[model samples]
Target: MNASKFGAEYALSDDMAEFPAGHTGAFEVPYPRSCCCSSGDADLLEAARTMREALQEVWLVMDALGAYQSDDDRLSILHSPKFSSAAYRVRTAMIKTQRVAI
Candidate 1:
């Protein structure tokens, strides 16, 4: 894995003070392989691990955003039921993939 690809970009701002210095922007997520014909159990495990890791990054962002108090309605959208449901679906997928790998 390219560790640098998972790093968040930093920008200085007053609102940013609540967040960690280096954890402000989006990180790169791995693109799904177009073909998995040659993939083996190890590959599946690695893919599942990658998904879990990527989701963790998302959760970190969500947590940070949730901790932030803003009057912006757009920001509130992130905490909506629909968004929670979507995140739950992804968590379910990760769990299923991990189970299959095990």
Candidate 2:
């Protein structure tokens, strides 16, 4: 996965700290335009919500994995029941999200 693609979602604001030295100007990130919700398209809204929840779950699991600093720690997490449960949910959510997206 491209880190830059995800970073595109983040925009530096006046409330945010200044960028480091040598930073130039800001460029507009390529954001996908949202669909019209007033059209009464329930399927689209459902798919969007599912995708968002799945992504959030994946993000949490990723943060948990980040706590493991060594191979042993990683192995322990790999064997954890919580890890397995999260993995299943993420996989299922991804499959559902993809189907609806198409």
Candidate 3:
């Protein structure tokens, strides 16, 4: 399935339709069954691209939270080394996924 279809299938709630801000809700990534059954390189590439889009959404949520909580000392975890590392890792994975070739 394509990214929009995949997203619609797994969208958390109506509230999440608002983009980065509303994405504060719980997020889940349901593995696509096509990846297990299909051997085509194109299928694999599509799956990779779908996953990359999901990662981008996740990055956007984190970015929104980081910006929203930029001043609150109690929410400083958003600025912590561990959080930064995790965000960096997600971005690296996004780049890798984008490079997948058919």
Candidate 4:
């Protein structure tokens, strides 16, 4: 949950739907997500679609975080408005901790 873990195999859980026949990421998959296909005709295109959608969602969330540091030398986060709630919270906490320690 904290960015260390990823991948289809890590997603298998009780909440996950039953995997399609021969599709085993770890155990269950609602449709098809596993790369391991014993089936003669594995329409990985379905899995690709799923992956694409998930990636798009991640792109939007990361973009909102202002996580990207552009290469342009002139652009500066220092002059930018606070970009995300997460950043703001962490910054505030760090400042408070420093003040308390002093």
C-alpha TM-score for every candidate: 0.31, 0.48, 0.32, 0.26
Ranking by lDDT: 2, 1, 3, 4
Model 2: lDDT to the true structure? 0.67
Q: Model 3 lDDT vs. the true structure?
A: 0.62
Poorly placed runs, candidate 1 (over 4 Å): 1-39, 42-57, 60-66, 71-75, 78-82
Candidate 4, residue 45: lDDT: 44
TM-score of 4: 0.26
Q: Model 1: per-residue lDDT, tens digit, 1-102?
A: 134677765446687677685665558699987766445666676666667765775675566566455757546667777567657757766766766644
| Candidate 2 residue lDDT tens string, 12-97 | 56644566644535476887658665455666677777767767766766676785467787778778886776778777767766
Comparing 3 and 4 on TM-score, the stronger one? 3
Candidate 3 or 2, higher TM-score: 2
Tell me the spans in candidate 4 whose CA falls farther than 4 Å from its real position: 1-42, 67-102
Q: In angstroms, how far off is 31's CA in candidate 2?
A: 24
**lDDT over C-alpha atoms for residue 40 of model 1:** 62
Q: What's the candidate order when arranged by decreasing TM-score?
A: 2, 3, 1, 4
Per-residue lDDT of 81 in model 4: 45
Question: Which 10-residue window of candidate 3 scores lowest in summed lDDT?
Answer: 1-10
Best by lDDT: 2
By summed lDDT, the worst window of 10 consecutive residues in model 2 runs over 1-10
